[model samples]
Target: MSVRLQLTDIKKTYRAVTALNSVSLDMMGGKIIVLLGANGAGKSTLMRILAGLEDPDSGTIQFNNQTTDAKSIRRVSTLVFQKSVMFSLSVYGNLAYGLKIRGVPEGEISKRIAEALEAVRLSGFEKRRAKKLSGGEQQRVALARAFLLNSNVLLLDEPTANLDPNSAAIIEKAILAKKSSSRIIIMATHNLNQARRMADEIVHIHNGEIVEASAPEDFFENPKSEVTRKFINGELDF
Candidate 1:
């Protein structure tokens, strides 16, 4: 039941500067794809576009083989930001807040909240103040919140940057544990090893364009692009 999300000839320009130049890529569902690039390399920009938070100057986004409005697409996508916003509330409160905001029924909310916490391996730290939690704990809270949404897609930006390896692994496990009946997960990461560990497809971006797209095995073993070669060899900083 996995479906592919397609971005066709996407272009974004800021004032006189071009941020993305006709970037086209296909992302298969039920698999993780890592977008690798340096700072200001349009990685985040592309994620934002996929999350429906930014509008491309030109291009089309098709989800599940159908073109649709951004709002509809957003309903099926979860965008986990680099810096998550935690409400001034308890961890349990934050975890269940999204369901509350969405007006889920009380019974369903309770069930979903519990399932989400379990999914993120945060079964006990419920009443703790979110602000007081460690960075990793707070991120797990966000993951729980997102999981409760049961979205079909995910867009993450540097999710493990501030997290300890243990906590990062927890979140990664959560992402990978989701039901693959119909889902897609995309992340923009600077961590090459993590990318290799998680991504099914490796998308190499530079300056403001996608230069290489390949399966993880091929991208690592036989990269075709100059930038990708330099990247795999750690010659390029990004």
Candidate 2:
């Protein structure tokens, strides 16, 4: 797969706390790279920076062979937060808002919405009030919304966190279904098992620094770092 994004010496700090420290990695298209870390281990921070929701204190973000602005970056990437945010609109409205803003034709919008909802298994939910849906349903809607954009990169922060097993399974299926050769998916998760299921590559972060990066098989069977081993064995607490 080609490199979709490159982060060089990325750093982010909040007051005295450093959220990332000289981090650098190349993200390739057509694969799911799971960021494995406990809470506050900088997974969310890294994802936020990638999504252009937050800027790094120091670093350069390169995309499509050029340094890009946040607007340009965000234009081709979409972030789904752990806590779903739905505008006070129906599911169709929520899904259509971004396309509408881009002035997509109504017929194309309808086609994309149908495909996205089907991908997320929410075919009959278009008229439901987004805010009135259950947490799991809302999360699925969020996934559908992102799928509609068909962005080059998809950034998900704890996509299945606090979800029931069935809900989590649905989200996982949606994620897998949405994969394409032109798209890159990066997901943050504390669950080792989920990472094993979804990740082609596993990136381990601890105390705001990346300690190990490897394929899922190697990461699970032959972890190179003490921190990674501890995390896999459930010895470390978030």
Candidate 3:
């Protein structure tokens, strides 16, 4: 089934700072939408809102045309952080935790765990300690954990930032492989090359608002906004 996520007039604030201002967007399944912006540009804030980790000060979210709340969104969305967060346990144990809580059959959990590990290219490391793995390995494990949930919406914040080239490439490949007609994948990144390579559509956000959104080709070659031009030319100071 195809899924559609719509955000309308979303606004968020943190004390004296406005994190998101009248931000609105629409996303559909089967495409990778890259949110391109510098640090402190509200990308993370918007992601958190989508993930149900934060409530917008003013906005409406519709899933498949039905108005929804944070609780409902949380059930169908998964957000992977920029940093790798792992439990102090074996990789298998970590991956099994969610399934266990959800009472998934033991056999089914094992099968899914294996498939998820293989997706991240860490199939045989299930017995290893998650925290003991290298940075790249840990991040892979994190991605695997998120994938295992099979959420309809996947939100990634700087997914490959600060990683070695190989790990980044592997993660990117895994992400692309996961795209399907029933899922919507949104990634936030500042890396122009990565965005250009992976994004079907690119949305530029600056100062807590969306500047423009377009296909990658037009986003780079024929930007309509001066802010986007500055961003493309490496002139935006954040």
Q: TM-score for every candidate vs. truth? A: 0.93, 0.96, 0.98
Candidate 2 clash pair list: none
> CA lDDT of each candidate?
0.84, 0.90, 0.93
| Better TM-score candidate (1, 3) | 3
User: Which candidate's TM-score is highest?
Assistant: 3
lDDT of 1: 0.84
- Is candidate 1 or 2 superior in TM-score? 2
Off by over 4 Å in 2: 1-3
lDDT of 3 by residue, 119-184 (tens): 999989989999999989998988898898888999999899899999999999999999997899
Q: Model 3 clash tally?
A: 0
Using lDDT as the measure, name the better of candidate 1 and candidate 2.
2
Model 3 clashing residue pairs (backbone): none
Top-scoring candidate (lDDT): 3
Give per-residue CA lDDT, model 2, range 1-238, as digits (tens). Answer: 4547888899999999999998888888889999999989999999888888888999899886689767788888999999999999999999999999989999999889988888877888889999999999899999989888888989999999999999999999989876777888999998889999999899999998999999999999999999999999999766
Candidate ranking under TM-score, highest first, comes to: 3, 2, 1
- Candidate 1 similarity to native, TM-score: 0.93
User: What is every candidate's alpha-carbon RMSD to the true fold?
Assistant: 1.6, 1.3, 0.9
